[model samples]
Target: IKDHLKHHQTQTTCWDHPRMAELYQSLADLNNVRFSAYRTAMKLRRLQKALCLDLLSMQAACELFEQQALKQNEQLLDVPQLLSCLSGLYQRLEQSHAHLVNVPLCVDMCLNWLLNVYDTGRSGKIRTLSFKTGIVSLCKAHLEDKYRFLFRQVASATGFCDQRRLGLLLHDSIQIPRQLGEVASFGGSNIEPSVRSCFQFANNKPELDAAMFLDWMRLEPQSMVWLPVLHRVAAAETAKHQAKCNICKECPIIGFRYRSLKHFNYDICQSCFFSGRVAKGHKMQYPMVEYCTPTTSGEDVRDFAKVLKNKFRTKRYFAKHPRMGYLPVQTILEGDNMET
Candidate 1:
């Protein structure tokens, strides 16, 4: 018990434990049980906030760091300068995130993520390009916008990325899941497989333009799935449905609202849905639709019709035919390196 307590104290991140990976994956799977990217992203954003790991917005990060007058993509910030910048970011975070009251601990975790993702060698210095890439990858922006911004960071003057440039982008993007302790769910930290998959998707071309890169991104590669999910989360950040959670009885369901297709007027709040709670007869396997925004009259009628249809479906049918929420692309390397 003494040794266990000591180990816990020494651990830096909340997800440093072996079980944390499984916990995060399970939570993600549970939140996205029906395979909606928007739902999955909302859960992750909640988790990120709860863990106090959601860093500054892209605009805020740019404002804070851009003031340094450093050369674009060529300058470097050593440990002291990096911490100073993080300190400023933390001050802004504290105003919004109440959980970030612990200034030292929060700043330390933020610094750790930045260094682990951008300064993997622990040289105590990070390139301006790497820093911007890391911030943009984790920022609150549209997934496609983030993708274009990241690609621009690595792309040549002709707006093309060679194998080496693509590899760099993947390397930095993978670190978000790594820092969140969810890297194992996304195929570990190795970026080679993801890079190879991208190039192969582009027909093994020597270089890929923005159009080719966007095509691959649309497939939702395992390593970068979180980016799209983050976008969904941001979309629904302020959404409030005019409904009550059947289980928890919370009014005006905030965030993603889940409405049952099998039952009339049955609604579940994000909290109840995430906790796997159900009312009297509603089963976990029942078909339901998620809404990040309020439903219109037409959408309500369409959902009602779908619900009436599902009512005729048997329990066995639902069990036999499970629905997938997202179609994640599995690369050739993934198939070759099957665990079992």
Candidate 2:
């Protein structure tokens, strides 16, 4: 009894406490054998939450000390199971702490715990699960314009999106991909431009995080992974934008900025093969390839590699000759059609 009663706050957890013994005792008196499964599941959920509270406490302490090294005497826990418990607690928070939640603490603590777990150098099995768990919770938190950080980390780990912070399509959507929920992969035409929303939901990182809505516009060449979804997002935008340009009303592009002119005329439509500017030498228009190429960046080729499926949503269209920034391997068929 003393072993159970004598407690350490860090050792004391919600799992052992939330399902108050009193509740079980009361349920025992009901003797409803037919309802045992429901009762048991509810009881289990409560236990998981309790465990999460303690795990979070420990995680907080670990983070507080910047303890990258696992403690010599940390509890002997099933790392994966413990991580799962933490995730369950977070998922349930939407049901309970959805209102009074400490937004920043939740974000910082979870990310710290996750970054530590990932660097633990163990068999990366738990790392994978822990990351997915932390990410889902992270998606729930306010982005606070933190997509770049998450984007960079994920890009390094998964090779999905560029880490350059390119200020383009990503700024619009807010969503992230879950490894278990969606098998993030190259599209190879598996997805189309019409249903980009479904692709974003399944693969788009920027869509997974709403930082774009908060105004973090940038133009650095980062890797954009999650290409299949990006194509859909781009296709959707292109379809909608095709009508925005006045000179090329039927062009395939959604919206475009000027690439530069052979002599500065705005009448040329790249997609339609309307070479040369209007009669009075207008700035070439429609296919604005130069501005889209992002020549200012000095990134390596891999720097532009799309690591995950989500980054494709904001893939850039830059010139192929001495390309300005790193570009996604898909789509982006090269610039120069305007001259042809």
lDDT of 2 by residue, 1-340 (tens): 1222233124422232333444335435322312221223233223223324312332342342233332321223343433343444454454555654443333324433443334344322333323433333233222232344334333323434332222222321111222111212122222233124323433555432334322322211111223222222222332322222235544434322233222222322323322223333332222233222222343222223322222332223222222221112222322222210
Error of 1 at 231 (Å): 3.5
Measured on C-alpha atoms, candidate 2 has an lDDT of 0.30
Against the true structure, whose lDDT is highest?
1
TM-scores vs. true structure, each candidate: 0.66, 0.25
Q: Candidate 2: which stretches are off by over 4 Å?
A: 1-124, 128-144, 148-239, 242-340
What TM-score would you give candidate 1 relative to the actual structure? 0.66
Best by TM-score: 1
Superposed Cα deviation of residue 208, candidate 1 (Å): 2.6
Clashing pairs in 1: 35-325
Q: Which stretches of candidate 1 lie over 4 Å from their true place?
A: 1-76, 81-112, 200-204, 312-317, 324-340
Candidate 1 local lDDT, 1-340, one digit each (tens): 2332344347644223333444456564554343333344555565455335455566676677667654466578875666676667667777887565566555555555566656666676777777777666666656787788788878999898999988877876776666554566676788887888889899999999999899888777777776766765666678989999999998998977888888899999877876668899988767678787888999999989988998899989766654423333232334311010
